[model samples]
Target: MDFVEQERMAHGIPSQGKITITVDEYSSNPTQAFTHYNINQSRFQPPHVHMVDPIPYDTPKPAGHTRFVCVSDTHSRTDGIQMPYGDILLHTGDFTELGLPTEVKKFNDWLGTLPYEYKIVIAGNHELTFDKDFIAELVKQDYYRFPSVSKLKPEDFDNVQSLLTNCIYVQDSEVTVKGFQIYGTPWCTIESIPSRCITALYDNCSAQDRKKLRRVVNTAQRITQTNLPSIDSVYTSRCLRQAANIIEDPSHPGHSLFSPLPSGRKSLCLKARTTTLKDSFYPAVIRLLNGPCIH
Candidate 1:
């Protein structure tokens, strides 16, 4: 069997590939539990809400919180620096080279060992496993495409979850950790050449619609349909007590909520209490096949 055929059999997914959705099952306490399906936001709508929600006010703040480490673009390169320690670890995307089972397993294995109360992972352009359906289809026809990828399978979803016991995978969803309200999304506009998954914008539309397509594509310039938020939109600590209506739980560790940071501010320091624990996060990093970051 060729590489494609061998790979097809190995994962039990079709040669054309498949799409997998992972819902995080969270339980703050035993009785109250919910499964979050927000990570797959771009593909599906929220069960009820039609519009994206404003970052909820009265967002909780878990007491005795600490540091948060944000990293991105590992590209199967987790061996370099010793990961920084924080209370929460946040990864943006590009978790794998081809989203192959082995690669995913390897990355997950590393992620699992990290010690943190909470870990958040969002998909990135390099995650080939996110589009398995396309790969399976190609293989069935015996026309193999290299570097083009596949999505996760139902069977493998558990594997992903198992690897990150403390992780909350957010596609287009939010999670409350310690006291922070974290929203995760694995989306960027960079195109993957052989991978139809990344070039999705052009896949369905026609050349005549290129202009329209450009707007829809996951380019860095326009990462999402909704524009990025502004810093003032978030409730930072300059007015914490008064902003209780804006923060969820202001006392928890790593209690972060996402809104836009100011134009020049690197990060917003929300008041309440500083979370000092050292946590490390791996964000999604795009791997270019031939060109610059795609739009």
Candidate 2:
């Protein structure tokens, strides 16, 4: 028996090397959950076929079926949450409330205790320590601003990543397991900008500020493009907050409602926040993927 694995984006562009598996016959009943197959490999083949010592095959067989249990936005509270049994555990991000190293470590410890065979995690806006550039920009604007609680420095990046050792961390990347392709990103739209400056920015800001603003906008556009590919599903930290009026009446507001941030001067910090949420806003991200967008 031969098993070939080919990874491709939704549009048919191959993204990874093809994995060919040759195995003996094995049977398992399929369940209502994701599909799973059992392969009893009688021989181990190297990247190139060669006569080598037979390798031990201790790999555990699937637990009857492939099941996925997903949760998101835990915000560092995991004790009371009851997790269901599944072959794969998916956490969509916001594992930490403040992105603090301590918080991250705590979440990681909790994740390590889960019974799932495969675990996947992604960062959320609250996980600021993961994105050094964004945090540095925020610090420059104002150390006292929102999401600056831990005073995280660029040096903490590796430390944070190291703490989450038990699960696969994904950021604007894709992973394949059991022939299923899963893509995850922590990006989300920042709080909405006030309607007042939506049109005034080009007229009043200084050249430097304008340049900064443009860069922010451009970065957001690029991030949005990352989601344009077709995929089985998307896992993201940011989720669309249903329009309030739409939910209330279904006719009062014809379009989605994005609440604006409290009125304030447009500062670099504000720009950074705006940039994160601007192009890749929840609605826009969902529209581009054309699939179920999990938060």
Q: Give all candidates' CA lDDT scores.
A: 0.47, 0.55
Stretches of candidate 2 exceeding 4 Å from the true structure: 1-64, 145-150, 189-214, 222-295
For residues 1-295, could you state the per-residue lDDT of candidate 2 as single tens digits?
Answer: 1122221232255446565555323212111011112121344332334353432333343433465677889998999777776678889988987687788899999998988888999887678778777666775666655545535566765457778898998888999876668899886541122111333233334568656755554565475442221111111211222333233564555333433324422111112245434334334433333343333
TM-scores vs. true structure, each candidate:
0.40, 0.48
* Candidate 1: residue 176 lDDT (0-100): 81
Candidate 1, residue 212: lDDT: 42
Give the Cα error of residue 120 in candidate 1, in Å: 0.9
User: Which TM-score value belongs to model 1?
Assistant: 0.40
